[model samples]
Target: MHLFSAVPRGVLTLLFASLLLSLADAHSYFIVTSPTQGTQLQNGAANRITWIKGLLDDIDAFDVEMSRLSVDGLILVARDVPAGSGSFNLFLQDVPSADDYYLLFLNSTSGVMFTTSSRFSIGDSSSNATATEPDSSAPTVTISGGPNPLNDFATTFPPSANGVAMPGWKAIEGSKGQLIGLFTAMMLCMAGGAFTLL
Candidate 1:
């Protein structure tokens, strides 16, 4: 019997399954820890952003995108946060001017989505918020991953291998691009073996 024909069907099945798992999409459970939703933050006051695991499985390194937008949709501040593991504490410095509301977004490397929490203007005065001291018990917002499989979340780019917190982004549906890539690889592998048999 030829070597290719002699190969068991179960062996081929196992190989396919392995490939599926490797290409299987991964997700993260992101949540906001500090500054509960709907809470008011004073201008120029330092507020800490709290988040759970922010890394997506396919992400190579940790990177965070922070943005502060005005009520008129003006961008006040935007930058990258250094990547790390587990729980993360992010600082909001140089707060926006005369802004009624602002949103914070976070993402993880292995995560397929981005989580967000918003804080509205606290007062009308132009006084600056004290730096360094963050109100620990100021009604922290808690974010968690959904138990349902069809989790709809927005994903951030340049995934952090061990990112703790990411900026706020809306959830989106799974990517067709990734699924198509997996199937194409399977077909190529199968064709290679068939040509050898001939």
Candidate 2:
């Protein structure tokens, strides 16, 4: 009878520990990328707010909620992002005028977990001024140095003694004909240069 009672107590203790561990591991990690903190946007403009959650772990989906503070400084506008997989890209449209401020929250559908806060002021978007320009005048330019034309060229590998070599570069001589080909090409180039000089 003592053995039976001890077994029950041990089982209960294990259950309690497991519950504590589960609760501790329930929080999710998320990052807000777009409409960054302290960003300003214009009213009725498209605002792209980005967030990432649990990048290391495989999750089913997540959600985002956005709200606006009213004239009385209260949370008035609230929106929710539906369940989806991978990273989160939420494009909120028709953001209200400058008189309002937004507070955004992310929660995982798997559990009641949030990533980070999405806060911003409307009517003062960062990109709003760029969109309002009417003049198509070319942007001012101040050239300081000569043009760098070859800056975009792909990097070329040097001649390889043991690995595969690049074109116009010599490879190590083998039982095959790579070294011979290189020798021939170099001789031809030298002869051409001599003829040109003559």
Tens digits of lDDT, candidate 1, 51-154: 55435533233333333453332231222333333223323334334334444443333443355555544432255543334555432222222122343222
Model 1, global lDDT? 0.43
TM-score per candidate: 0.36, 0.35
Q: What lDDT does the true structure give each of the candidates?
A: 0.43, 0.40
Tens-digit lDDT track for model 2 on 11-35?
6456655654554445435666555
Model 2 TM-score (2 dp)? 0.35
**What TM-score does candidate 1 reach?**
0.36
Write down the worst ten-residue block by lDDT for model 1.
139-148
Shift of residue 74 alpha carbon in model 1, Å: 3.5
Show model 1 residue runs off by greater than 4 Å: 1-27, 54-70, 85-100, 104-113, 124-198
Best lDDT among the predictions, by candidate number: 1
